[model samples]
Target: MEYGEAQQEDESTTKAAYNPTEEDIIEYARFLGILEEEDAKLLFIAREGIAAPLPPEWKPCQDEDGEIFYFNFSTGESSWDHPSDSYFRTRLVR
Candidate 1:
């Protein structure tokens, strides 16, 4: 099988026998090397069920392609990536 197909099969098998926790997901993301450790944790907080809030001025938007982006009301600035992602990461770590 191709690498992507093999990975999908392995992940399915792992999920079939196990209920993964937030930390487990984080660790698995780290193992995949898709994101740095800190980034993975922040991603969980941002997209999973975490209750953290972004700064009031920043709003999240999605393009037609369904990718998320951020816009700052105060500065009228926009970015494809979250502008305060680093700040959120620090807050989550503390």
Candidate 2:
């Protein structure tokens, strides 16, 4: 398996699936009262896999979105950045 990809047991659908639809993304942002576009963009990228794991120094969150604790991918010079179940729920599935 490719690094960062998941195995059968990692399926989020079968698991606690946190796949956020476009609507969900918007709602989540509002729910958290995060109005900054950059933060929203980061969250959006995160929803689409442009996001990455929080830095080693960062602590893991108990939620699936993990946006609450998500560290910025880049401050001024960085760029770039899983789960699922039945019917090929990729990203989370493997």
Candidate 3:
């Protein structure tokens, strides 16, 4: 069987199964305008069986333009520039 077909079959045999294609995830991320293309791609890769977990000090944050980035508190760095002096923030904030 093709790799995708096998994956779908395996997923179907499990409860609460919902396997999303890479393209689908990327498109959805783009639609939400929450993640920059590269960030979205990295996220997709991370979700797809990357051996290591994302850095513990890294958090998902968004810019004023609604583009998502990874903010590393330990390093005081981000995947993209954010407003100075502002805490790393996400849309989930109330």
Candidate that would win on lDDT: 1
For all predicted structures, in order, the TM-scores are 0.41, 0.25, 0.35
Q: Check candidate 2 and list the clashing pairs.
A: 12-84, 13-84, 83-91, 83-92, 83-93, 84-92
3-89 per-residue lDDT for model 3 (tens digits) = 211111122233134466666555544443436544643454323322222456655454555554556657766554323212222
Model 1 spans > 4 angstroms off = 1-51, 88-94
Q: Write the per-residue lDDT of candidate 2 for residues 62-91, one digit (tens) a residue.
A: 234322222222332211112111111232
The residue pairs that clash in candidate 3, if any, are 34-68
How should the candidates be ordered by lDDT, best one leading?
1, 3, 2
State the RMSD for candidate 3.
Answer: 16.9
Candidate 1 lDDT over 50-87, as tens digits, reads: 23344677665555555555666677676654465454
Give lDDT: candidate 3, residue 17. Answer: 46
